[model samples]
Target: MDGALEKSISFILFIIIGIILKKKISSGDETNGLKSLILTLALPATIFIALLKVKVDGNLVLYPILALGFNVILFAFTPFLIKFIGIDENSAKDRSARLLIPSLAPGLSCFPFILEFLGDDALAKTAMADLGNKFFVLFLLYLVALKWHYKNADFEANSLKSKLKSLFKTLIYEPVNMFIIVALILVSFGITIDKLPNFLSITLNRLSFIMTPLVLIFIGLAVKIKKQQFYQIFSLLILRASFTLFLIVGIILFVDITIKKDILIMIAFTLSSASFWPFAHISAVHFKEKRENTKEKTFDPNFALSILALSLPISVLLILGILTAGNTFTEINSILFLGTLLFLIGIIFPIINKIKKFLSKTTKEIKPITKKKKIQLIADK
Candidate 1:
């Protein structure tokens, strides 16, 4: 009966329908085709509308700065966090986790819900936040990954300038970025969405309408993760989220966020799924390592795929649940409890595995002594 409840249910239903249709949508290209539409057409349109609708100002730049700050913080701290999962330092899998855990792909995982629940103003804010995340994942992570590649492959870094220049081109030509720039230019010239010609404004609105359902279904269709890699990625993702919650709590404590929805926007945007761009960087490095015939590789591409596959559902569910709960996570104490709870959940399995190993070792030791004791007693008799 309630509006928010209705929207949440519809989204869940779309995702469930996607999961059900996964069998029919068997090809990767089929999924990619859907993704192409979302990224190039639907998603960009939605973001364009959101941006145009909002008043542009100098203060908006702070969103990207803050988002970039979060990325750097996560990157610095992730090495320590991955150690909890027994991911050996400097291993291929370890490197893959490090590259992924900090990047944010909010378009597919975050924006739809923000639009549906938090409204366009919040979505506009989040779109700005994503700009910083884009730079982190695209340029910074590439450099970091390349450094790792050089370390393991034992080759001097080459063509970095060419690669970085190419990434700059990608950053410019990307459909979302294009729309954002156009929208800003329009806003600067004193033109808002309502001020635009009826034909142009109406078309953008129609395109924005498809973004939510399309994303929800794509998430549904893309939901394929192996059981073996599930636990490790799942735990790490939870820990990542827990840390993000802690950060948001700390920010709210100091920053003056008067709006409740704004806090939710920050939480939801930061909790987005790991970007697919980092995987592209990993793939490129893998290709180079192969050509150079390097024995020690930089990243495990399979491991990276596993991380990305599992990330979407986990982040979607988390953002959805927290947003659905409304102001529940707005308080400091509630968020603290959530962060601590997630942190404990992340470590519990590793702790259990250690206890199991200890018990098995104790049993093995006891069996040998028991056998010796029985033999001695029998001889005496």
Candidate 2:
């Protein structure tokens, strides 16, 4: 718990610094540069290091599959959740949430905590889990965005094959993917990061060290909030948390994840923040379509931004609480903890609305005496 708290505090401090820099210095270009540093250098180096450290085997294979299974299941269920929350099916939020809510962004939010609290083995497992999610974000979500962009339009008119080819090209050329490919080859031959040349290993270690602060600061710089969309974002957050809680309970009841450390990892993974890459891909499509003067609404940038802004704090608090509890709580207590949270979020808003209405009615019912009536009463007296 202390470790979790310390890590959380440090993470927030970096984010706050980023926010201040964005406000005072107009670090827009700098922030973009930092993000490029992350995607092109820091993140890829970090991934390669993690991949090389872990033994590639049957248990390792289970991680990506488990992660992908979670993504797919959540994806299948999101539409119903969207409908339940009363979001308009035709709205841009709907389109974006379908992609955003199901994906996991452990790199930015979860990794630092794992490193600080659970050490490298846990971090390795988390990184492995993230591979499946990365695949979804880079490939499947890209196709979904393209489809939404050209849905009503003719495929031949837009040269769909060329568009897809371009998309695939973008995916393959990303430094992250390239590094993954290289790392896989190395691991296949029983190589590890330590076996690399001294200079290369030192340089990579330094780059990877910057990953946490740089990513957290970039996230802070990128935080843009829309007041109108806040409620929708909150609803989506609640929905995500509730579903995750349900899954946690299911795991406790049915699964044999007996190791406390593993259980903690699973809980944290289940509650990881939604990834930003899907939003990035979707935003690119929207921007390109806007340039081309396409009339169809593509994706909602505001909605995506809202999710990004809210997900960090939501995920941090959940992880912090779980970690502070220290994996000692019984299964019933774990269920009760999540159940209480779910209950509060579900019931609080309606109760507040009812209270507001009652107060309004009571205020309207009481009237002030008019001057004429007061004068008549005084004269009569």
Candidate 3:
């Protein structure tokens, strides 16, 4: 618990420091560059390092299938649920997007943490599971959902084909995938690299350390909560949380897959939050559309930010509660605790923003009276 608490605190501190430094040193371009680094470099490296040494087994192989199956079930049944709930088509598409997009990086988000907690063997199995989920999301659900959302627009097919091509390109170029392939080839031939020079291993290990916190901070930096969209954002958060919880329970009960408790916690964490990348993509697309129309668009930065911020803490707490409640808090407790800490750190940004907004408003109101008094004094002079 202490270690987890410390990790949470450290996560919060680093994010705050990053945000502050970003404000001072990072222009919009720099911030964008930071995002690019996370997506292209840090995240992929982390995934590769974590999965490279992992050992896969039959149970591990089934986990991703179960994850993909659950996602498929959600995508198929959620539309019907939306229809029954009387949500409009546009709203249903948004709901589906929220549900489907996060499945893309379940492994990326959870695998490193799982590796830290469970070890290479568990991570390898989890990677296999993650690989399945990523393939299903990127290739299947992502394309289908994009088509559903944009089907009626002019140039729909062209747009869909473009998106499919983008997805394929992403898959082909992803460092994580390349790493997996290389690692698999190595492992298949019984070529052991674990005995590699200590210095290189240390270097890779240090690089891997940068991956998780950088990602969490990137998530924090990306999500900016505004005042007006609080209610709507909160509702969406509840929707995501509810859906993830339901999926977790269903997989545990109905699925024949057997994973260790730590892995289960990782799966729960991975599925529980929406993917930050898709939100960035959606936001970018919306921004472009608004620009082309020559109309100002109200993009809800806070909505996704709030969702991510809230999801982290909830996931950490959920993981901790489950572990502690089951009395299964073994060696992995440190990792679970760290995860919870990271989430708690995530929650603070919104709170800080709210406070800053309140103070800014108060200062603005006070400034008018001070200006009036100064003007009156000048007249008297």
Q: TM-scores of the models, in the given order? A: 0.70, 0.77, 0.60
**Candidate 2: deviation at residue 270, Å?**
0.8
Off by over 4 Å in 1: 1-56, 155-228, 361-381
321: Cα error in model 2, Å: 1.2
| Rank list by lDDT | 1, 2, 3
Name the best candidate (by lDDT).
1
For 169-256, candidate 1 gives per-residue lDDT tens digits of: 7558767668878988988898999998999999999999998788667767775567646787788888899999998888898887
- Candidate 1 weakest ten by summed lDDT: 150-159
| Model 2 lDDT tens row, 1-381 | 466566767877887887787866555567657767877898788878877887655678888888888888888888877766667785777988898988888865687777776789998898888888877776678778767776744567768687778667766876777888898899888889889999999999999999878867776787676654566577667767778777766766787556778777877887888886786676567656777777766687657756876787788887767666766533556656785676568545445555877999876665444656888899999
Give the top-scoring candidate (TM-score): 2
Tens-digit lDDT track of model 3 for 1-381: 445445555655655666666567554676667766765666555655655565657677776775677566656654543333233455534443444334434433344445555557665655676666655654564355445434423454356667668556745665555665665676678654485578866776777677767766765666565554443344434444455544554444564435566445544444544455444444443444455572323233445455565555544554445444443432344334544554454345455556877999999999999999999999999
Candidate 3 TM-score, C-alpha based? 0.60
Lowest-lDDT window of 10 residues in candidate 2? 327-336
Determine the C-alpha RMSD for candidate 1 after optimal superposition of all C-alphas: 5.6
